[model samples]
Target: MDRYCRRAGALALAVTAATATGALAQDYVIGVAVANSGGLAPFSQPAYDGFKFCVDEMNASGGIAGKHPIRLEVRDTRSEISEAVKFAQEFVDIGVNFIVAPPDGDPTMAMGQITSPAQIPTMTFAGTAPILTSVGEYVFGSYPADNQQAAVLGAYAAELGYKTAFLLKSPDAAYTQFGPAYFGTVFEANGGQVVGEASFTMNQPDFSAIVTTIQALNPPPDVIMTSAWEPDFPAFIKALRGAGVTIPVMGADVLDTPTVRGLGEVVEGVVHTSGGYPDPGSAHAEFNARFEAATGKVADTNYVVNGCDILGMIDAAVQAAGTTDAAAVGQALAALPETEGIMSSYTFAGTDRMPMRSVVLARIEGGEKVIIRREMADPATMPAP
Candidate 1:
C-alpha cells in the first residue's frame, strides 16, 4: 500500500487498545496528548500513529519485557493550550503510569505543569526546546535538543564553504528563536558571519517582504538558515524561490515533513538535520517495513519513527528500573546507557533529558529526501540551550 493509505488505515484504528496474542500481563497505561486536527497535527498525527504501531507490536510480542501489555489512553489537544492542559489534568487525575505529551513547546509545557507535579514520567516525542525538560524532573524530551540540531546544521554550513549567512528568525517558539541563534554561534566560530537577520511570525500570509529584504542585501549571503516549519516554511520557500533567491537554505529536522517535501522543485537543495535514515538493511528500515505490513500503509512523515523511539526509550527505562514506578522510570530514563532505536541510537546524556544522538544531514534532491551525512555533534562545541 502507498504511504498515505497505510497511514490512514493505521490512524483509523483505536488508539486505546491493541490486539495481543497471548494471556495479558500487568498492563501499563500510557496517556497520550497530541494535536490531531491543528497546526501541530502534521507532525503529531504521524508520531501518534507510530506510537500506536509500536504498542500494537509490543502487545503482539507479549508487551514490554515480554510480560506487560500497554494500554494507550489518547486525547487530541487540537493544538490548543487549554485543551492540552485539560487532557493532562484528566490523565493526572486518573494516575496514568506515563504520559506522551504533545510535540509543541507550549502544549508540552502546559501538559508538564500537570504531569510533573503528579510525578508522572512524561515524554514529548519532538519537543526540542531545552527548557521543556526544566518543567520538572519527571518531564523528558525525546528529540535532540534544539541547540544540538542548530549546531549540526551550522557546522555543516561552514563545512560546505558558506562564509556568510542571512538568518530568518521566528518569534513563534523557542525552537525558532534559540535554534537560529545557536546556528549563528556555531557558524561564526567556524569563520562564518551572520550578515543580517529578519524576524517572522508563524502563519504569516506573505513572505515577499522577507524575500525582498534578502534581495536588498548588497551581496547575498552564502546561505540562509531558519527554524521555520510547516506553513511558514512552504510559504517562505515558495516566496524565496519565486523571487529567484536560489541561495541554499538550512533548517532543523522539523522541515523533514511532507508539506516541505511536497513543494518539490521549490525545496530542492534545502538541507536540514534529521534522526536517521531507514536504509534497506538497517533497524530503521526493518521498523518502517513492519509499520507498512502491520498497517497496510506507508508512513508519510519521518516523525513516525520518533513515536517508535519514544516507546523504545520507555521500554528500556522500564526494564532498567525493573518497575513501572514513574519516578524510578524517570531516573532510569535519564541514566540510560546508549541504546539503539528505530530512528537512531539515543542516550539521555546523563540526566539532561535531551537525547544525545547522531544527526542525519539530508537534502531535497530531485524532489526526494537524500542523505548527505550522519554524525554526532560534539557537545563541547554546541551553544548553551
Candidate 2:
C-alpha cells in the first residue's frame, strides 16, 4: 500500500481492503465495476447482468483453465467518474486478478489508469473513444471507437442510396461532435451530400423548436441522423414524427435505450448501429438462453452480450497465456487468434486495446429491434485521426 501510494500523484492510493469471503488461495478474482443507477443506468445495468451471468456460468463449468474457480467483487460506480476511481483503487487493494471496467468511455479510461498502475488487466465493453487505443497494454475494449461507428453509419447511408442527409447533434458532447465530423467524411466520400444541419442544447427538454427547424429544411433530405442519448432520445424522435418529418432516421449506438426500443411500431425506418444485434443461430444463443432462465429477462441489448463476451475474452487471454499474471495475460491477449464470442469474433492488435470485429447495423421495424447485418467499418471511410 505504501509503495503504491508513493507512486500515486492525483491517482487513487491503494489502501488495505478485505476481499470477498471465499478462503481458497487459488480463487481467480474478477472485479466488476459498474453503475447500477443514475444517468448511465440504461447502458450499465444490463451490462452488469451480462458480466455476472458469464462469471456464474464459468464457475458452474469448473472455472477458467479447468481448475481455479472464479470469484467476483462488484462495486457500483453509480455512473460517476469519482466513484469509478474509488473502485479501481479498492479493487487493486483487495488483490483482484482482473477488472471488468465501467461501461462508459470517460470513466472506463480513468479506471484503466488506476488498474494499469496496479498491474491489473482491465477490459471494457462501452469505451468508444478513439484515444482509447493508446491507453497502454493493460486495458482493452470490445467495441470499435466512435470514429469507427461513424464510418460504418456513413457507408451504410451510401449503400442505402441516400443521396442527401441532415445531421442533428448537441455541440456540448464530444461524441456528438465526432458523429457529424466523421460520419460526414464517409458520407460525402461515398457521393452523399449534407443539405442542412441543426444543433440542440444538451439536456433541453423541449425539442419542438428543433424539430420545427428540421421540418422546414429546404428540399428535405432522404435521411436524418441524430446524435443524442436516452431521455433526449425519445423526446427528439417523438417530436420529429409529431412534426411530420418522417425521413428515415439514423443514429449511433447512444440510441440503444428503452425510449427508442419502447417506441416499437410507432418508430419506423429508424436504423441504429451497435456492437451486436439480436440474430438467430448466433454464437450467443446458448448464453442468451441461460441468461433468460437465470434472470427472467432476454438479453435485449448488445451491452448484455458485450458483457458476457468480456469475460469470454479474459478467459481466452488466460488460456492463451496459461497464467493469471497481468502482464503475461495482456501480452497473450494482444496476440490471440480470432475467437468467436457471443457478440462478435475478437482479435486483438498488438499495438492497441481496440478489438477487431464487424460493426452491427440494426433496424426498428414493426415495433421490434432486429439485426439487419454484420458489416465492417471500412478502413477506406475511417475519419482522419
Candidate 3:
C-alpha cells in the first residue's frame, strides 16, 4: 500500500481498537484524587462525599444508560501538590477515563499538568484559578475563578460603604494570593482604601503578630478582608476579636469551607463570598434533601453542591459522547450550553473552559450561615492573569 493509504488504515485500526476497548468494559472507572488528609481535607472530604452521592444516585437510577456501571477510584492527595502530581501519573497509568482533582488551585494546576497532556478529562474542586483551564482542553472547573468571586465581594463592600479594609492574605496558595489581589484592586477602584495588608502562610498557627499589625493602625480599618481557610481561618478571626478589633470581617470563597461554618456564633456577622450555595434554586434544594436522606447528614458546605453538580455534568457529557473517550467528553462538555445543576447553571464558555455561573454572598448570622445574595459572576471584571 502507498504511504497515505497505509497511514489512513493504521488510524482506522487504532480507532476501532479504542472503541472496542471502551465498549467491552464492564465498568467505566473515574479516578478521584482529593485532599482527604491535610489542611484542605475538611473541605475536600465533603466534595468527595458529594461526588460519591451523585455517582451512587446515578447508579441507583439504573446505572448510566442501564448497562455500563461507572465506578470511582479514589486517592487522597493530602492537599499537597507533589502528591497530586504523583497520583495524576498513576491515574494515567491505570487508564482511567476521567480524573476528579482537588479544587485548590495549586494541586489542581499540578494535576492538569499531568492529566491534560495525557489526554485525560479533569474537573477540579476549588476552581480557584482561571489558569487551571489554560493547562489544556481536557481540564475543567465549575467555580468562577478567584478574581470573579473577588470582584463580586469588592462591589458588595462598596455597596456596604466600606471605607477602609485590612487585608490578610494566605501567601502560599494561588487560592489566597490571586483572590486578595483582585479584591484589593476592585475595592480600591470602588473608592475604598486598603488601610494595611498582612501576609501569612496557612500552616502558621499563630495570628498574634498579624492581629497586632492590623491593630497598629491609628483608626483601624472599618472592614477586614481575607482569603484564609480551615485552622487558619478560625485562628485569624479569634486573634482579631481577641485584639479587640471589632471591625466587620469580610472574606473570600475560602470562608465557605465547612470548617469555617463550624465556627458558628464566633464568626457571626462575618461576610463571605462563595462560588455556590447550599440551596441556590429548587434543583439545588432537592439535591440537598436527597443527599441528606441518602447519607444521613446535612449539606453544610458549598463544595458538596459543586461536587454533585460537576459529577452530574460529567455524566451528561459521557452520555452525549457515547463513549468514555477523554477527547470526545471534553468536546461535548465545552459545547454543552447553560446546563442547570444543583449549584448553578454551567456553560464551559467555548475554549475558555471557564463557567460564568452565579456567585453567592453569605453571612454568619445568629450562629448559622444565611444567604445574603446571589449574582451571576461577570467574568469581564476579572483581572488579567
Write the residue-wise lDDT of candidate 2 on 1-385 in tens digits. 8877667732432222222333243788888887888767787888888888888878887787655688889888888889998999999899888888776667777888888877788877576666654555688877766777878888889999999988887776556656776787788988999888888876778999888887787788888887677777788888888887778889888776566888855478689888876566767776787789999987777788888888888889899999988778877887877788777787785426677677877888776767787776666567754
lDDT of each: 0.86, 0.78, 0.80
Q: Which has the greatest lDDT?
A: 1
Give the per-residue lDDT digits (tens) of candidate 1, residues 8-86: 8776563323434344356888999978898888888889989998989888887776778888898988888899899
Candidate 3, 109-161: lDDT as tens digits: 78888889888888887567777788787888877777778788988999899
Judge candidate 2 at residue 152 and give its lDDT: 86
Looking at model 1, the pairs that clash are 6-297
- Select the stronger candidate by lDDT from 2 and 3: 3
How many pairs collide in each candidate, listed in order?
1, 2, 2
Model 3 stretches astray by more than 4 angstroms:
1-26, 65-67, 262-265, 278-281
Question: In candidate 2, what residue range of length 10 has the lowest lDDT sum?
Answer: 13-22
Rank all candidate structures by their lDDT, best first, as comma-separated numbers: 1, 3, 2
**Could you tell which candidate, 1 or 3, scores higher by lDDT?**
1
Candidate 1 — which residues are off by over 4 angstroms? 1-24, 349-351
